[model samples]
Target: MSGAIIMLNAYFSPSDLAHVKICPSAKWSPKGEIVAGINGKGSEPDQFDTPYDIFIDEYNNMFVADSLNHRIQKWPPGSTKGATVGSMARPLVGIPYPTKIFVDSEESVYALDYGHDENNNSIVKWRRGLGNNGTLVINEGIAIGGLCGDMDGNLYISDYDKNEILKWSPGSTKGILMAGGKGRGKALIQFDGPRELYVDGTHNIYVNDEQNYRVQKWRPDHINAATVAGGIKCLNDFAVDMDGNVYTVDSCNSIVQKWSPHSSTPITVVNGDPSGIYAISFDTYGNMFLCEGNENRIRKYSIIYNDC
Candidate 1:
């Protein structure tokens, strides 16, 4: 259940459909040739059922949110099989359907459940080495689309129903409105279907305004958001590297673009691949991994650059 290592020869090139230009001094390439996945792509223990999100921990263990499977599978580095870390079959009160999974600095796992019980969308936390079941952290009645954590262990969730983002401090029961509590709009303070988000060390939030077709950057404690990148169709997810560069996946265009801070234009890193990518993430080594929903596989890409 491993993926193939694809070596892309041209870093950037001008084509009839998508124009890409590679810098003479710098280029992009793949790293070591270790690509792994489940046995085929299904609901079996060794398979994945429409994985929507993935998180790599400090020890290089990967946690995948098997959305349709209603479980989270933990795959150790270099291991072929994965163990179920969290699942709806666990002793939980309601039907816990996990949509997104986030691992904090302490290796604690948090999942955003769809709340099939009474429409009580909740965020559950599971400490490292603990059992499958998680403790309820936030049980507010809101439709959550994405979940991410800051460096200080604070959690941020995107409310698709409210068209806003909610923030929850560690050990807090209730969540406060961080942004977009207003109705959906194209304004600076509103969000129309805010799906995926990433919070940096400085507490600044980068959210994918899916329906608005733009990615927004909201500074700490700021109500107004500035558009970092836009004009793409159907932005699915985004990830921020250690250097503050933002990478976003466009479903409609079938490409992933890299946008430097405050830059209007984006450099095309991942070319147009028609697999229907649903999520994007970065590991500790700056390697990028994307979850292709249709292909039922996760593709890894390494970044190569220079000072110029």
Candidate 2:
């Protein structure tokens, strides 16, 4: 059962927007048909005020994290769709700066509030229709901006300022250090600042390891330290496919590279010059969804199987 890799067509609107910019983060729906992410428009002279973070939900609902506008918008899955859901609070629902969002099986929304004030930064979880209900509070000087969850219902947060990952269970305040804290020596490590995280079926924790320019894997049971995947460059967010092959968004390289535990070199599976990929993900069926930041769109790549 060998697997083949190939780059597919890019997805975006040419008539509506005309220009592609930067897409920060992207997520695939549980059903595998939709994708959502942040679309940053104009980096230089243009100065387009279109910084919309989109959410492609299971039902194909697109939610945009409009940062500068101070709101989250929604775009339903259809031909006649556009952004709908938004943070209408006087000052923007206290979700000042949202980095990422995760929706559970129950449709509950979990957003990472980088926070207006560094001291007030927190991870907010809101019920489907009930708006923002406080779940876990990090008021004690702990700022949570990135997040991921495990099979057993435990939540993992990337503490950028602290340069570590904190483990939080249901109704728990005290978090255990999963990786990169003060005691850990800051090398490729000891992340200069950690970003997003992904937990696999085997309980392996994959930290973005952002500033380190690679991804780090660690086991909950074995917390001695973290291991690098293959010394990637400018790794944004990485995801494990159905077969456990690791795929990372190499922004600097403008391509999505695939890695394996046995391989030293990563193979480019997708390419777009200066694409500026912010996130990468895989659906249950093995399809790859890339958040092309420079293109301001989410493109899908089918993993072609072949004898390797």
Candidate 3:
């Protein structure tokens, strides 16, 4: 099972590629077409003048998490280029480094904002229509910052340093530790520095067990843990296809491995580029989007099926 999704720097021209820098993460809208990502220009630690994660909304509105700039930016539909959108631009809401972001079906935006030097990360929520009145859903309390909302509207977060997944109901204020502990694999059910999180239609939560080198699935109704995919060397992120096939970024191996439900063997689809894949998502059209952290760009791939 092999596939490829070639991606171009949508923000630049082929002739200017030599002079442009790229970002590290990418995601597709629920409807696909528009691809969003966090971009940082230049080399080294301080060149990130406009370090932001942006996505085009359902209405083609671009929402940007202007991280270091401490703001949520917008680019309304039809704006070919610029940082502002829909009349309101320039730091709509104030904050710190807004790194990871997720938008729920209700149009509410959830952001994982990096905290102050002594504070933990924060999970902030921007309620649609409420505008600037949006509140901080979760405080500066999590270890790392990845967010996902389930079908039922429940939020699942990855607490990196704690090596666990946290869950919160639709309107709840506190988060409950879903899996893992403070230490690496503290118990048989725990993991080692879990990163991104995904919840399926059946409400099964999948955690990218980063340092542990595997993916763990936990049912909303079950407390026991199950290794849906394993034996991966240096795993970082993954996505579950509509048919339940698991596609993962086997980083150290420089390939995206797909595993059928409960299968022990994996099918490698890309190879020879050991970049840290930080994110993955499948579009409604069945095409897949991947975030090659070190590749500094997003790639799209279509899965062609052959009758055996």
Superpose all Cα atoms of candidate 3 onto the true structure and report the RMSD in Å to 1 decimal. Answer: 11.4
Give the residue spans of candidate 3 off by over 4 A.
1-95, 115-119, 128-134, 181-183, 273-276, 304-308
- For all candidates in order, the CA lDDT equals 0.69, 0.53, 0.55
* Residue 62 miss distance in model 2 (angstroms): 5.7
Candidate ordering by lDDT (highest first): 1, 3, 2
RMSD of each: 9.8, 11.3, 11.4
The better candidate by lDDT, 1 or 3, is: 1
TM-score ranking from best candidate downward: 1, 2, 3
Clashing pairs in 3: 5-300, 74-85, 75-85, 76-85
The numbered model that scores best in TM-score is 1
Candidate closest to the true structure, highest lDDT: 1
Q: lDDT score of model 1?
A: 0.69
**lDDT (10s digit) by residue, model 1, range 1-308:** 11111112211110110112223233345332224453557877667777777777656677788778778888776667678877775544222567778876555667878756534577776665766767666666767788877655566788887898887665555678888888989999999988888776567788888889888989986769989888878787777665566678887777888877656788877777536788776555555677776666666776576334
lDDT tens readout by residue for model 3, 42-145:
32222223433444333444455545545555545444333421111223233556666666544566677674532376566565665543355566456764
Q: Kindly report which residue pairs in candidate 1 clash with one another.
A: none
